[model samples]
Each structure stands twice: as C-alpha cells, then as structure tokens.
Target: MIVVISGLIFYFVIRRIRKQIDEMAEVLEDIKNGNGNRRILSETHEIVAPLAYEMNDIITSYENRLSAFRETEENNRQLMTSLSHDVRTPLTTLIGYLDAAQKGIVTGRDKDDYIETARRKAHDLKDYIDVLFDWFKLNSDEFAITMNQVEAVELTRDILIDWIPIFEDKQIDYSIDIPEQPFRVNLDSDAYLRILNNLIQNVISHSHADKIGISLSKQNDKIAILVRDNGIGIGKEDLKHIFERLYKCDKGRSEKGSGLGLSIAYQLVEKMHGSITAESEQGRGTVFQVLFPLAD
Candidate 1:
C-alpha cells in the first residue's frame, strides 16, 4: 500500500512539471509574435522559477528599447514635417512675388514695390537656408572649427563696427561698450563672429525694442558678452525652450526666421567651452549673456 501511494505522488509531480513547461512554451511563442507584455509566471518554490524571472527581465529590457526606438522615430518624423512646412510657405510666397514683378503685374511705384518685396523675400529665403545648413552640419558632426588663442576685446569691437550701419538702418538705438584693453581667450574666430551675429540678428528680427545694447567685459576667470533689448519680452515658458532647435516664440513682431539662430548660438558657444543664458520679463525686455573661460 505504501509503495502505491509513493508512486502516485511521483506521477502527480511529473504531470505538474510538464504542464508548467507547456505554459512556458506558449508564452515564448506569444513573445516571439511580438507580444512583449506576456510573462511566464512561477512561484518561488517551483523548479523553473529562476528561469522564468530571467526571461521576464530580458523581455522587459527588450520592450524598453523598442519603446525608445519608436519614440525617436516619431520625433524625427515630426521634425521633418515641420521643416517641409516652414520651407514651403516662405518659398511659395517668394516665388509668387518674383513672378508678379517679372510679368509686369503692376507698373510705376507698384512695380518697384513688387521688385523690392521679391528682393527682401529672396534674402530671407537665403538666411533661412543658411541656418538650416548650419544646423545640419552641427548635427552631422561636420562642423570644423580651428581654435586659437586671440585678443577678444579688439575682435568684439571689430565685429560691432560692422553692425553700426545696420543699427542705423533699422532705426534701433545702440550702446556698445568694448574695453580698449586686450582680453585673451581661446576661440574660433569665424564661429565667434557667427555667434555674435546670430544673437544680434535675433534681437533685430524678434525684439520690437528700438534700443539694443551690447557690452563685453571680463568677470573673474571668464569673458562675458551681453546682448540686451527692450522688446516685448519672452514669456516664462517660451524662455525655457528658446535654445532648443526649431522652437520659435510667436512673440516677434517681425518674426520671419528659421527659428534656429539662438539654438545655433548656444551650441557654438558650448563647443568652445562657453555658456549662454537669458533673462527676461513679459512687457519688459530680454537680455542674453555669453561667457567663455578666460585663456590661461
């Protein structure tokens, strides 16, 4: 009688083990068919519990990676869509104006106005394309900069000299102060020029303020440069994302731009071991400050 009871117990245990194995196989098949949520359940006392836990961990990791990949793909798709719309709208308008001027749709002063409008559109298109190119280069790891130890104050002054006439044309008041004494820093001259240009253009294009000020000075172990404008200041929310790619505040009066200027400026400064920051208040003004570590 005792031998028969032992035999029955052995048969039941084997049967249960086989049943669990079948269930595990079914779950693996589901996972293979892309149901990553399926998990093999097992109690701690079971013989296959450790295997089940390990498989669950692997599946979780796979699910996480797949989710991340899908997110990146979606983001790329959105960026491409935005790029197409931004380019098409400006380009279509530019071509329409040019075609009108060419076909003599208007005469005398009206014709001249059409031509001028076309010209300005052409320039705007070019600027937009240039920004796009820079953004692509930066992202593609193709931007090459040759850093040099150079005199910064004089360079800043020279750069500001070219902007004086532009300020006059825009009827924007300017107060530029660059110390006469030399301040040395490690920089890429062309990159630095582009950085300053983008910041100033951001003010002229976005800021409705009539007065703009640029100043350069040394702060302890760093060189500081500031671009300030008394325009309709950016909102607190917009300010947080101003340096992100393709983010444009609907706040500019003459807000025709590629929405990449400040972002590019921020990146260029970062590549050269510098920092850029902004301070602003609604209905008050905006100030952008750039700081570079002073050369040893």
Candidate 2:
C-alpha cells in the first residue's frame, strides 16, 4: 500500500510538469510565428520566470533591429534610384551632342555649341558625384567639421560676391539684406561656404526664378539666414521630402538637380548646431530659413 501511494504521487507530479512544458512549447511556437503576444505564464516563478523575461526581450530586440534595417534599406533604394536618374540625364545629353557631331548635324557655331553642352554635362556629372561622395562620408561618420568663431555678415557678403557673376549670367535679380555690424557664430568656415554654395546653386538651377532674396539677421543668441525665390515653388508633397536623400519633385523640377544638394546642406547645418526649414506655395515662391546659434 505504501509503494502504491508513492507511485501515484509521482505520476501526478509528472503529469503536472508535462502540462506546463506543453504550454511553454505552444507559447514558443507562437513566438516563432512572429506573434509576440503570448508569454510564458507559469504559476511558479522559480522555474520559468527568468526564461520568459529573456524570451520577451529577445523578441523585442529582434523587432526593433528589423525595423531599423528596413528603414535603412528603403533609404538606400531611394538614393540609388535618384542617382541613376541624375546620371542618366547627363549621359543622355552627352550622347545626343556626340551623335549630332558625328552625323554632321552640328557644324560651325552649332558644333561648338554642342561641344560646350557636352562639356557642361560632364562637369555637372562630376559635381553630382562629388556631392554623393560628400553625403556618403557624412553618413558614415567619417566627416568632421573644424569649427571656429567667425562673423556671419562677412561670410554671407563674401559668398554673395563670389556668386555675383553667376547671378548676372542667369539674368536673376538678387537683393541682399544684411547688417554691416558683425554677428558671430562658431561654425566650420569651409562647411558653411559649401552649404551656401549648394543652396545658391540649387536656387539657380532648380528655382528658375527671376528674383532671389537673401537676408541675414541676428536675434538674441541666434543668427537667421533666409533665402527666398519667386520661382515655380515646391509642391506640398515635395516640400515635406526636400531634405531626404535623392528625393526630387515633379518632372520639370526633377530634371534640375541630383537631389543631393539640399540633403548635404541639411546634414552640414546640423553639424554646425543649426537647423534649416523650408516654406513654399505652388505658384508664389519658396523660402529656406537657416538658424545658427551665436557664439557665447
């Protein structure tokens, strides 16, 4: 009778343990199916509590990592698409010019014009490649800005002076509204120049506007620079994505840029402890505003 009682007790304990194991197996199966809702809810905390917590943590971490990877892959796809389009445009132009020259369709001044167009396309391609390389360097955390205290007004004036010839050639009128007094900021001079150059070139190439307005002002501990153009203006949809890598707007405006200019400018601004914003209406105009914190 004593032996029989012991056997019965052992059988009951084994059955209970088997049931708990089966429940855990089912929960793990659910998790393997990407259902993270189910968790081990063992009544006795001594055996499975730590295991459940660890499993949940693993699931959460995997989900987060997957999400990050998807985002990065999407960005890379967009970049590649934009790059292909940008490169193809110039290549097409170059081929067309070369074909015309070879077929004797272009001669004298027309031939010279064709050659110039091909050369310009080549230069544009080079510039686009350079911008892409810069963007990649920035993204890879390989680029560093050497910061220094500089007068903001002087910097703006010098950049404007350098671009005056291009403005004149494009038949675009520009107004500069900057104070003669010094407003200083701690920033990378070369980076700042590149930012300005990219912004101005973007306006010239993409805006196609007759008038450009630039204003620099200081308020409290910040300096604000505004670049406005009475151009075709950006669409609401496109405005939201202007800073995204290689994102372009409509076909007409799309052909104008490699789409890296604004992105690089955005990155450079952040590096300088500044922020940039854009505002536009479909037909009226577009404005880009940049704010930089003044040196303490």
The candidate that wins on TM-score is 2
Please provide TM-scores, in order, for all candidate models, with all chains considered together.
Answer: 0.77, 0.80
Angstrom error at residue 12, model 2: 11
lDDT of 1: 0.88
Model 1 TM-score on a 0 to 1 scale = 0.77
Off by over 4 Å in 2: 1-51, 102-105
Against the unseen true structure, what C-alpha lDDT does each candidate score? 0.88, 0.85
* Colliding residue pairs in candidate 2: none
Off by over 4 Å in 1: 1-72, 250-255
Tell me the deviation in Å of residue 80 in model 2: 2.3
- Model 1 lowest lDDT segment of ten: 250-259
